[model samples]
Target: MTVLLTGLPSAGKTSLATAARAALLAAGHRVEVLDGDVVRRELWPELGLSPEDRERNLTRIGSVALLLARNGIITIVAAIAPYAHSRAALRAAHAGVPFAEVHVATPVEVCRRRDVKGLYARQARGEITGLTGVDAVYEEPLTPDLRIDTTLEDVGESAARLVDFILHGPVLSSPHGGRECSGRF
Candidate 1:
């Protein structure tokens, strides 16, 4: 199974992925999280931050996720993946594999407020350019398998809902108020 968790820099994508990975591990499933930061640093350190570079990075990560899925491992990808075409292509390429997308739909304003890396600040200061959802385009997913809003729910609940979807199917608003489970959020 390959779970693609997409969101902006501070949208809690990595945090959600981490929590989901823990859930899978606790359930005795073999899972790995390929966070954008860790993948950039360890796998494709040479890749720049341009749109083209971001596409290339996502392509590489998608390949890795497919490989892990082929080996019967659940791979969780926490990446910005700001383009819809790239995500669509990746999902289309994985035939017969369990490929799911969970968009962490945190608003840009909320993301800016949660910017632990100070990326939004740097972009505002003109120290950076092509920031997704800012100067560059994000091309938000129109129909993701699930969508979680960090501004509405915390990381743990988001992950639990995601893991539930991965293990079963959509929960359709569990008693825990997972509107995300209904694929409406």
Candidate 2:
């Protein structure tokens, strides 16, 4: 299964992914988190934040998630994925696979306040531009499997909801087995 968590920066996508990964692992389920910042920094340092580049980044991440998911790993993806078309493309690519789109619907104002990485501060200082949900664009999901606002729900509660969805949600059985896949994370 691949769970794609999308939202503005500092909207708690990574926190939710980490909390859910811990619980899922505690339940003896194989899980992996593909965080967008880490992936971009480590794998695609040359990529800029242009729309095309962002789409390309998302495509690459989706490919990796699909590869791991096909092998029975529950892959949790935390990415801004600002473009609706890009996210839709990923979903289309995952046809017949267990895929869930989670929208971290935390408002941009709240995210700016959280600003875990000082992105908002940098933008405010004119050190950066085109920040998603600010100067750039973040096309909200038309219909997502789940929608969460971090300001309303804490990490533990959000993670519980995600874990429940993974375990009990309607997911197509993999070739490897049923809900309990038999492979790596």
Candidate 3:
């Protein structure tokens, strides 16, 4: 299964991914997180933050996620993935795999306030270009498998909710299929 987590900068995408990875690992699942920042820094160091570079980066990550999922490895991807078309293409490319899109819907104002890296401030001062939710637009997910509003939920709660979603399926039941459940937050 491949869980593609999308959101604006500082929306807790990486935090949720890390927590989910830890929870999944504790549950005996083979899990890995492909974080966009880490990937950009490590794997595709030459890729800039331009539109073309974003596409190339996403393509590489999507391909890697597809490959890992096909081999029964649970892959969690934390990326901005600002373009709807590109995300749709990624979904199509991973057809037949258990792919879940999780949108971490955090407001731009909140993200800017929590900007640990000062990315939003940099963009405001003209020090950075192509920053999502600032200069560049982030195409919000129309219909995501899971949607977490970070403003309303803490990171631990959100991560646990996502873990529950993945383990019990979209309907929110027990992983062992013991009883049907409902009312997932």
Candidate 4:
């Protein structure tokens, strides 16, 4: 299975992925996290933040995720994934595999305040441009498998919900706290 956690920078996607990974590991499931910033810095440093560049980057990440999933590893991806078309293409490519696109729906103001990587601050200082959800375009997902707002719940609660979805299947929830689970474990 492949789970893509898409959101703005510092929107808690990486932190959530880390917590969920730990929980899944503790439950004895083999899992791998492909964090976008780490992957870009370590592997694809040549790639820029342009739309085409972002699409190429995500395609590469999706390829690796698919490979891991085929080998029986659960892959969790934490990425900005600003383009809706790119995300849809990745999902379509998964075909028979279980693929879940999870929108980390934290507001931009909250993310700017968190600023875990100082991205927002740098943007503010004019040291950067094309920052996703700021100057750049982040085409939000219209209908994701799940939508999580970091402000609504703590990381532990969010991680538990994600782990449950991974171990079982889709756990649908509304922004206001209603939940409905479906599919087999």
Candidate 5:
């Protein structure tokens, strides 16, 4: 199973992924969180925030995620993934796996205000280029499996809901797995 959490910067994707990883571990599930920031700094150090670079980064992450899922590991990905086409490609690449897309639907204003990493501020000051939801574009997910409104829900609540969703299957599906996934968050 792979849970891909996507949103703009400061949208709590990392926090949610961390919480979900901890909860899944407590439930005796082998979970791994592949965070974008850490990946950018450590693995893809030469990659900048250009559109092509971002797509390359996502491709690398998606490849790792698919591999982990194939090996029965619950992979949690926390990435901005600002392009809808790339996200769709990822879903297609990992078809038939228990893939869930979680959109951290935090408002841009709120995110800018809570810019813990100062990304939004830096973009405002022209110090950072190609910032999602700021100088660059973030193509919002149109049919995400889970759309968490971070402005309304806290980290623990969001994590709990995600855990429930993962453990019990989609909220619209039955315990026997007889139904197709149809519900949206």
Candidate 6:
């Protein structure tokens, strides 16, 4: 299974993904977390967050995700993935795999409040450029497999819902219950 956790910066995407990854591992599942920030810097240093650059990065990540998913490893990808086209391309690339797209639907205000890195503050002060959900774009997924609002749910419960969905399929009472995934591993 390849789970793509997408949202704006500080949207709890990494926190939620980390929690879910832990639960999956404790449940005897092979799991790994591919954080976009860390992976890009170490693995794809030449790549960037520009539209074309992002698509290229996402493609590389998607390939890795497909490879792991086929080998029965649950790959958790926590990325802003701010472009809809990039996400669509990833999904299309892994057509047959157990792909779960989870949107950490925390609003920008909430994310700003939780910005431990001061990214929002930097952006506000004109110290940074191309910040997603700010100067740059962050296209939300139209029909994500799961939508979790961190503002309304704690990290543990959010992770539990994700675990339940992956293990037993989408539960009726999802965190936000906006849309249901067709199937999952």
For model 6, the superposed segments whose C-alpha errors exceed 4 Å read 170-185
User: What is the TM-score of each predicted model, taking all chains together?
Assistant: 0.91, 0.91, 0.90, 0.91, 0.90, 0.90
lDDT preference between candidates 4 and 5, better one: 4
Give one digit per residue, the lDDT tens place, for model 6 in 125-155: 9899998897888998877878777776588
Candidate 5 on 53-157: residue-level lDDT in tens? Answer: 999999999999889989989999999999989888887788777787777888899889889799988888888788899879999887787777877657888
The digit string of per-residue lDDT tens for model 3 on 125-185 reads: 9988888987898999887777788877677788888888788765311112122111111
Model 6 TM-score, 2 decimals: 0.90
* 2 against 5, candidate with superior TM-score: 2
Top candidate (lDDT): 2
Show model 2 residue runs off by greater than 4 Å: 172-185
Query: Residue-wise lDDT of candidate 1 within 1-185, one digit each (tens)?
Result: 88888888888888888888999999999999999878988988999988888989999998999999989999999999999999887887677777877788888998888887899999999999888899999988888878787776667777888888888875322212223642211
Lowest summed lDDT across 10 adjacent residues in model 3 is found at: 172-181
List the lowest-lDDT window of 10 residues for candidate 4: 176-185
- Between which residue pairs do clashes occur in model 5? none
Instruction: Pick out the ten consecutive residues of candidate 6 with the lowest summed lDDT.
Output: 176-185
Tell me which of candidates 1 and 2 scores higher on lDDT. Answer: 2
Per-residue CA lDDT of candidate 4, range 1-185, in tens? 88999988888898889999999999899999999888888898999888898999999999999999889899999999999889889887787778888888888999899888899999999999999999999998888887777887788888888888678764322222223222111
